[model samples]
Target: MNKDSLNTDYLWFLIIKSLIMKNVDLIFNEKQESTLFGYVMKETENKDKIWFWVTIAMTFFIMLLFALPTIIIDPYFHYHEPLTDYGYTFYRQRYSNDGIVRHFDYDAYIVGTSMTENFKASEASEIFGYNFIKVPYSGGYYKELDHLIKRSFSSDNDIKMVIRCLDYTLLARDKDAEHEEKDTLHPQFKAPEYMVNANPFDDIKYVLNKTILFNETYSTYLNIRNEVPTTNFDSYSNWCSAFTFGRETVLGEYTHTDDVQPEKEFTQDDYEMIKGNVEQNVIATINEHPDTTFYLFFSPYSICYWDTAHSNGTVKWNIEAERTAIELLLECPNAKLYSFTNDFDLTCNLDNYKDQVHYGEWVNSDILVRMKNGENMLTKENYKEYLDEIEEFYSNYDYSTFAVGNEEQ
Candidate 1:
């Protein structure tokens, strides 16, 4: 309880503090000096070596985890055994179409935008007496169409007929011009220079992508279980009437309705651009392939579309462009022109279309039947008359009935 007792206590406290400081310094110094210390530490050279191998093994395992599905499912159709049944549900058409062209022994190709998607390959084969494959791009432009047709013709198999649905919008641009920024063709279809160059290393993009990996995995599972649908028609079998009003529809489900109207207009300059595109892409391709029979049909967009065209002031120019296109095709001995655009009963009937532009599959099938039967084949003789009739029909037709809120009236 004196000054000497207080000094003794202070000395004991200093000694304990010194020991605690020393321990703290050791821990801090070890952390600062060691490369791997906090969670995983390698104090000895042997431990360092073990850690390095472990890291390498872990990386290799991760890489394999990503790469195995790419190899097994082979979504790109890059490798695997014959009859492996590569499913098409999740397959990207721009990439898959090349493989289909290269591997499938089809003589004829049905190539176009989504309008051609519903055209049955089986019916075409049966009627045309050639093996058929439908290569459709949902919103394809002429450039995409040209690339697909060129690829089909360049294949090893015997090149027969090519049935193409001419999309009028595609003709709005110059054939050689690139797509507009807002409407660019899918990257899968755009350049394909990677595929052409056969760059194996670039495939790492596909192999590592989570989306591609999941789709390929799902597709492989479907294939293994034999639950995969036939890829011949692609997703067309799922397409139904799309006019179900407010009802939700999946692929293959469409509806029939008589209520629709046009809301677009066109100009003289638009016609000029369309003409140039048709000349550069369509006519050029037809002229290039003299030996191949080209059956080109203008898509039967519904009357609502024509109303929009008329509203846009593009109706007359549109007819003129068609006449020009038909004349050009007729010049080519092997090219057959079919003018379904003038089929009023088919085009005017709202029941035949899922939208302003997309017609039902039955319309597509009937076109094929007519083509096979040689009916409605547009010759130089009938071409003028057909255009006249179409013009008159458009002039006389009243679009007020299709007004958005006039269904009851």
Candidate 2:
């Protein structure tokens, strides 16, 4: 061996020694041998434990941020105390109806489609001697009304009167017919069962929804400022005006430039079925609550509606159904049947209507006044006379002259 060979041997020995020391460091300590397999194992376990705790902390923080406030300050669940009176503009009626009936302090309920929305609850309350809450569901069917009536009766609130504005189109629909598609009622008009049962899923849905959250926040601001949406009818303040037009403008808008056919014909059986459902649902509801005063009135649609009905050959059927409904309702001692359908002075004037079917709130206010005054009511003795007059007016009305212009008219 030479000096060069000795140097190479020493270099190899140093390298080998360094490798051995590095391997020794990977071994577990004698005391830690039972707990940890090696240094890498211990480090990996520690990292996983830290990650698990961090993830848990993040989840709890998220829950606190979103879930906690929504649960505690539930705006949709009206039963929860310190409720923010967000008004009907932001109000999700499907979720809030039962809650309002259950929690709000009101004695009379104004039930109907959008027509009744214009009927001032304050005015009705004054005349009927009851505190009133307007629960108008747009395009509501009799079944919807029945559900509301039952819920109103079921609630702890003192429900003395139910002022229902009956829409003739709804009366003509089948008993099982829903206002919405798929035979499913809108969430705003669903039965109180889910709400009454305190469904947590429903609560969470409204809580986390972006639209609902926005509305709630906006409503809170409105409530704080005691402000109402421009479109809203303030029953407390007697502000019932709902349209932008003066009487002249409304009439001009509805004045048709051409004759149009907007009516659909129904078979005799269909008419009968509609009448039967009305009796079964409406009349039965009236009879059920003898202690409650039921003011059922036909909402006055425009003359165009009647013209369409007559042209479609369904006017007679509609009249027959109306007659039957009136007769049945008259039988119920608790019911008072009013008819605004033949109010030619109002219905004939196109200016009074926003559309063919929807009249302004002034007409609604007039109807409420008439109901309180016992005017325009169709009793069994005079319903025939009223119906005959309506039929005659519908028959003689020159729909062709009025229909020649606007398709909407």
Report the number of clashing residue pairs per model: 10, 11
Cα distance off (Å), candidate 2, residue 9: 72
Model 2 lDDT per residue over 187-300, tens place: 454443455444666654555544444345335544546765322223422223645543345445554434344444456786587777787768888888788888889888
lDDT tens digits by residue: candidate 1, 1-409: 6786566446544654565455444333435654333224435556566667756775665566666666676665544322446555533555566556666678898888778877888889999999887877667688767766776665678787889888766666665775333312253335344433246787666566554554455446557578775455534433645444211211124322334335334566766777677777777877887888988888877777776676666676678777766776688888888878777777766667656777767888899999888888899888999999998888667867655455443
Which residue ranges in model 1 land beyond 4 Å of their true spot?
1-65, 78-82, 85-91, 177-201, 226-230, 234-238, 241-272
**TM-scores of all models?**
0.71, 0.72
Candidate number of the best lDDT: 1
lDDT of each prediction vs. the true structure? 0.66, 0.65
Error of 1 at 229 (Å): 5.0
